[model samples]
Each structure stands twice: as C-alpha cells, then as structure tokens.
Target: MSGLRQEIGQKAQAEGFSTPRFARLAHDLEQQARLRAFIAEGRHGDMAWMAETEERRGSPLSLWPEAKSAIVLAHSYGQEFDPLERLQDKQSGVIASYALNRDYHLLVKGKLKRLGQWLSHRAKTKVKVFLDTAPVMEKPLAQKAGLGWQGKHTNLVSRELGSWFFIGTIFTTAEIEPDAPEQDHCGSCRACLDICPTAAFPAPYQLDARRCISYLTIEHEGHIAPEFRVAMGNRIYGCDDCLAVCPWNKFAAAASDARLLARDALTSPPLSQLLELDDAAFRALFTASPVKRSGRNRFLRNVLIAAGNSGDTALVPKVTALLSDPSPLVRAMAVWALSRLTAKPEFAALRNDLMNSEADMDVRREWETA
Candidate 1:
C-alpha cells in the first residue's frame, strides 16, 4: 500500500473500522450478471427497490463515473456469544447480533464521513460515502479491495475480522492503487448451508431471499408465509444461523465500541413481553436500534410467530390480546399463535366468538387455516 493509502486506512481504524483497503472501480460484467440473474429470478422477494435500482447497482462506475478509487471499510460488530445457542430457549426471541443495539447505519456512516472528509481534503477531490442504505454492491467491492472474500453465505468474511462486520464505502475522484482481490477460502465447508433453518441457500453462494429468515422478518413487509413460520423458531428480528456457523468466526472478537453491545432486555427477549408491545412502547424500546425500522406492526407479527412456536401456555393471554389488534398482520399471527398454544375446543370457541368481527381477508384466512 502507498503511504497515503496506508494513512487513510489508519484513520479508518481509529474510527472503529477493522479492515480497510483500496479498489479501483472498473467494469465487472460477472457481478452485473449475477445481479441481473438474482432480480430476473425474483429471488429478492418483496424488496421491489432491488429491481428498480438494478442499473445503478450493477456497477460502481455506473453509480459514479467520476469515482476512480474506493476505500472499502469493514466495521466489526462480532457477537460476544453464540447467538444460535439461544434458539433452544423457544420462549425467548433470538435477535440478530447486528440489531442488538443501535442502528449500524448511523455509526458506520459517521465513521465513513470522517474518513471521507479527511481523504477529500488531503487529495483535493470530491468524495461520496455510503452505508448499507445505498444500492451499492459493497460485498463484491470489499472482495475486490482485499478486505475479505464473500463467503458461501454471501457475507464478506475477513481473515482478521471474520463475518460479523458491516461494510462502509468512500468513493473518491483521487486515484489510489488497488489491492489484489482476496481469493475464497470457503473450500469444502458447507456449515453455513446445512445449518439454515429454512434451507434458504439453493447452493453454495446463492441465496433465495424469499426463504431467508432475515428477509422474511425484516425486509419483507406483509404477512410471513405459513411455510416458513415453524422453521422461524423464535427469531423475531433477523436470523444468524448461517453467519454464526461460519468456521472463520473462530477468529472473531466482540465489537470494540461499547454502544454495540446488546441491551439487557433485547438479549433473548421474552416472547410474551415482546407480544405486549404497543406502538409507543415498541418505538421507545428500539429508539436508535435497527429493529425500529421494521415498524411496530410487522415486528409484532414476527414476535407473534415466535410466540406461536414457543408452545408456552403462559404467553396465551398476550397472544389472545392481539386478536383484536388494529393491524391485520398482528391479528393474523395472533390467531396462528393461539392455535399453536390452545387446544381445538378452546380455539374454536374463541374463533366462534370473534371470527365474524374480523374483516381483513388475510387475517380471516389465518383464522380459518388455524
């Protein structure tokens, strides 16, 4: 690395980025092809924005022609414990490690801007920074920059930082020498694939987002399909099965920032308590957290699914209360949860008492199906 490049990387490290490297933006037809195929097949599921932004997202040059080099930075949010271990405790919800605390976009975007402003002033060029909010293909670019290789689970995994990291990018007009891309080290390991609760991966390196728990619980807006609910277990926000099972995670360490640690209540949250969250309470609890973006209704929907899978009779009252919820999404899942926890005679009596009052077609279907 050049002295200037090394200096910028050192600055990024000070900003809490664990890995930083340079990549010259150039045409990569293969990455574009894969993106096209993913959208063409409709594997992106309910996220219509992926199809809308396909052209700009296809290539770095297409997004910003003036940008010659990108400083790809990886910020680690490595989990302190094995997140998968919490799954056995079905009464509690397993939140993805990344969403355990504050939104990473706020933290990472601040760090990227700090690094970008410094580089722009020193190099006398315009710079643009991006967090996960953009359509940019960060993982591929991170691989090109030698920060990490895209593991079979499709998350960038660094030799130093493992897979528990978020990517930030600073595209600049100033030309910087590019680092050689990292080669894949995921050889012969299918741990990420075998451990998936929903069998989301069709093959190594390919993900059908429709089956992905993270997408189903977060990006997906409507009612989650019945097929995946039982498989979902108690994962209320996002799933970490594949990421947690990676062999490279052995090198991972806890996040350096104190703010990244999960809140006491958020860690293995009781499904019954989560099911009781009103809009105001939910907003208050997840104020700066990524889970807030899911909105109260959709989040409650996921929590109800966890409640349904919990088989804990103690949560019955909480689940029953949601039957009259304004959100059809929540009401539907509440019906499902009641069925899972209550016996046929009891559920039938409750349904008989309330079914006629329910107007939403989807929620009615859930009532009928249950």
Candidate 2:
C-alpha cells in the first residue's frame, strides 16, 4: 500500500503535476483564526460562501473524519508566451492567463477524479476528490502538505514551479504518511505588493478581494466603483498584473495540458469585438470557457470600462450601440464610456437624452463631466 502511494506520486508527475504530497487531516487553529480575521474585516466582498462553512474550512478532519490523509497536487498552467505582453496594446483587453483556455476547475477536477478512482481501486477504501469546489481550504492544505509555502501574495509558491500552478486534493480513508509542512521563502520581496495596479493587497499574505481586479471583473456583478475603472486599464475579464510581475514566475513552465494552453481568439483579443458581443454571441464565444460565467451584460459592462480607458475614439460607435441595452447595468456603463470618449459637446448633444434617460445616478454622474 505504501509503495502504491509512491506510484501515485510518480503517476501524478507523469501527468505533469509539478509536485504532489500527502497531508494528514488535522486542525490548525492559527490558520482558522487568520481566515476568521479576514472574513471579520469584510475582505471576502460578495463571496458569501467563504464565510458560510467556517467549520469545514477550518479543519480537514472536521469536514471528513473518515479521511485520514489528503493527497495534494499542483499543476503548472503558465504559458511560454508572456502574459504581460497583452498589456502593451492599450486597445486590447487583458484576460487573465488562467482563463485564456478552458475552465481550470473542470480540467483539474477531472484529473483529481481519475487519480482518486485509481487510488480507490488499489487501496479498496473510500476516496473523495476536490478541485477548489468544496469548503476545504486548498491552499493551506497544500501548504501543510509540503507542496509549497504561501507567498506574500497568499498564493502557494514552490521553488521549482513558482506560483503558476493550480492545486487539487484527494481525501481518502487510507492512512498515507504525511509530508512536512513547507516554509515561506519570500525574504524581503515586495515585488507582488508594489506591482498591483489597484493596491488590492492591504498587507503581505492578505488580499482584499473588493479591490482585486480579478474579483471585481469576474466575481463581482452590477456597477463597478468609480475609482478602480480607469486603473483597470484594458483588463476586461481578469487582471494578471500581480501574477505577471512576480519574479518567481521566470521558472514557471508553459502549460502541458492542451486545454489549458492559450486559445487563438483569447490570446490577445481585440477590444472592439468584445464590446460588440450581444448575449447570444457572448455565450457562443465562451461556451465551455471560464469567461462565460460572467455573462454578457457584466462582460460588456467591463468592456465599456476598458473602452473608456482606451481613450480611442474608434470604439465610440461600439459603445454608442449599447446605450439602449435592456440591462440597466450595461446601459449605465455605455453612458460612462461615451462620456469618457467625448467631451462637453458630446455631452451637450446627448444632454436631453441624459436628462430624460432612466440611467442610474452613478452613470448620470459620468455625464456631469462629459
């Protein structure tokens, strides 16, 4: 059985997972307190689920007493193509590297399930797999399992793989030996903190999700705050400035998974085409991809912000067409984009429409300076 555990690790390596480790299911009160403090401070933003299962997230044993061991896995998804290169084009929206290909949750979960099934067949014990879907604190579990240490950015960073890997876990009744916990290697490195465009990191090892571009553009819905929009640059979907600026990523490998590799359309998408995506078109464009979860209305809302920041008059017509969108959110952003594109004359021209328009107060505010 022990030899089989080693075989599993070898198999994981063969499958392109950078590192794999086993961790005993146990409580970590100190880590739990940190999570509580983060939630107490309202750092989670609209992600209510993070606070819902406090107990389960605090301890792996509490979630499943029968699970004696956790198999932690890390897969590198970074591409050889520099993610930061997209930022060079002021007119193109920068989608995060993780979302450039297929949804990672599905891809990693499928891999975990395959591994778990193999372990169950060999050990004749119950095995349950997770890929960032459960109440389990995956990063902490991975850290405790000796996969890597959580860096200043609060992401697990390994010496070899850097922080460009996705984590997966498998809980099993089999009593596999545990690995020693990894220690932090970030010695006086504030590169990640200094690189944030929105200052999302309030302190080292802590993230205020509300200010995070990834959170705002993807998880967040409705109107975006006035302050962060311009700073958002052309990152319409998710921001990678923090991830791209990390010095450790030089060691990160290009994705071995074909599904995780960057697709042609998303590699460096034109901002104009993104702004023109209607509901059906958006759905079809990102059908199986992670981007579809944001929906067309919110996505177009982001595009409007990007268009506004673009300072390119070429996107004016695309922004103008969305003013009459059924979704008030989209309409409001359209007004904001048009305002950013044109000056007082454009505002005066659209003054009567702005006055009579049923736009939100926030959107109307953009017109005040138009």
Candidate 3:
C-alpha cells in the first residue's frame, strides 16, 4: 500500500506535477454543505453549473462509485514576475497570469491522465482522473490529502507552493493511506480582502462572485455593469489582485514548466491592439489559450471597459470604432469607454449621430446614458 503511494508520487513529479498525496474515499459532505450555502446565497452568480451539478459534487464517489482511494497532485503556475506590476501599465490590457500562455486544462490534465494509465496497468485496478473540469470539489479533497489549506480567499494555499498551484486528482478502487489534512495558517492577514478593486469578499472567507472581477470578466456573459467597469481597470481577461498579494507567494518558485511561462503578447497586451482583434484575429491570437473559450465578443466587452478606465485619450478613436460592433455587449461597453476617454461634447455628439440608428435596446440604453 505504501509502495503504491510512493510510486505515484515519483511518477507525478516526473510528469511536472508536485509529489502526489493520498486520501481514502469517504461519504464526506462537509464541503458539500458549504457549496449548498454558497449556491443558496447566489454567491456563484451566473455560474449555474455549480448549482446544476450540486449533488454530483458531494464526493469523488458521486462521480465514480468504485473509487476507494484518491491521489492528489498540485501543478504550480507561479510566475517569475509580479503580475500586479503589469496593472500599472494602464494603456495595456492585463491578462491573468494563468492565461498568459498555454491552457492548464490541456497541460495539467494530460499529464494526470498519463499517470493514471501507468497506475492502472501496474496495480491492475481501475482509475479515474480529474482536474477543474470535474465537479470533484478539488480544494477540499486536496486539503484532505494534506496538499494545502483553503485560505481566507477561498483558494487553496500550500506552504511550499503558495496560492499558485492547480489541483489534480486520481481516484482508484485500491485502498491507500490518507494523509492528515493541512491546517489553516492564515492569521490576521487582510491583504487579499483589502486589495480587491471591486470588494469581492463579503466576509473573511466568503466571496461574492457577483463582485469578483474574475467572474465579471470571464464567466459573466452579459454586459459588465457600470459600477465594476472602472474598478476593473485594464484587466481584459481575469484579475489576479487577490492571488498576487498573498504573502505565502514568497515561498512559491517561478514555474519550471516551460510550457506554462507567459507569452510575450499576453503579458500586458495594449488596449489599442486588443480592441482591434476582430473575431478571426481573436481566434488566431488565443487559439491554444483559455482566453479563446470565453469567446471574442465577451473578451472585447472587457477590453472596452479597460479602455474606459485607461484615461488614454489615444484610445478614443479605437474605442469609437467599436460603437458599430455587431455584438451589443461590445457596443454597449464601447459607448461606456467613449464617455470616459472622449470629451463630454464629443461623446454626446457621437451618441446624437449613432443613437437613432442603433437598434439593440441595450446599445440604445448605453447611448441614452452616455
């Protein structure tokens, strides 16, 4: 039993994953109850999938009945540079550090799948692997496996890896020893809470996804509400403010995985350049990246808000061009951006010129408000 755990850890580390930890399958519902409360309070916002898969997320066995043990691994995506530093360049759109290069889903999950295959063949037992794509409540399972503790921001924080690692798991019928769960280390630190541009945290450990810029920019499909636009600043993809400020990050090393390093273009993409990304260009820019999954219209909608916050009058013409964008999500945000970057009279003139011709009620509302 102990040999199997050692073997899996060695194999996972060889595959660019952290040394694996083990946890036994159980009928635990502690995390599930918290999930229920989060959904009941509508803290998940438009992430309806969390509610849709509520029962299935109860435990690993919910997804696989035959499982008796679990193997957990962490893959670090820590950056060499401070991601917050990029936020200072207001003229450029800041993408979350995680999405600055290759998508983790493909890289992390692919490595885990190979590890699972090896374990199944060696032990002659069935195995199933999972990452963020599954409803397995990975953070809780990771904590149970002694991988890390869920910190004040509701993200798992490892003493060795800080807050910059992705969790992966393999569930198998073979019984293995479960490691002692990691204990909470967050004391009086309020850096992650106070640094939020939109005040996403309602209480110490409670997050309101509605106010989260990451949710607003990535998951929320509709037009960004006016209040969060300015706070969003130049973040066009996702916000890393809370994650970057964690003091635990001092222990995190720069990612050794060459595949996960930040791409030159995505590090601090200029708002002017990003705004010019039409559908085809957008696809080309983010073909293998996670940003593509959010789709062009939604990404542009965020960029326009960043443009609004930029105060870079140089972007005014580019922002004006998006007024005629086919997507109302883009056009509405364009109206909002123009109001900020251009003079009031110029914005009023553009509205007077474009309002009557605008058909979408949402775009018309933007014009009426501008």
TM-score of each: 0.98, 0.96, 0.98
List the global CA lDDT of all models: 0.91, 0.85, 0.89
Put down candidate 2 lDDT per residue, 301-329, tens digits, no spaces.
88889998998999888888887788888
> How many residue-pair clashes does candidate 1 contain?
0
In model 1, which range of ten residues has the least summed lDDT? 1-10
lDDT at position 248, candidate 1: 91
Cα distance off (Å), candidate 2, residue 304? 0.8
lDDT of 3 by residue, 154-207 (tens): 889888889888898999988888899899988999899999999999899889
Residue 15 lDDT, candidate 3, scale 0-100: 94
Pairs that collide, model 3: none
Candidate 2 residue pairs in backbone clash: none
Question: Candidate 2 has what TM-score?
Answer: 0.96
Model 3 Cα shift for residue 304 (angstroms): 0.5
Highest-lDDT candidate:
1
- lDDT for model 2, please: 0.85
Give the clashing pairs for model 1: none
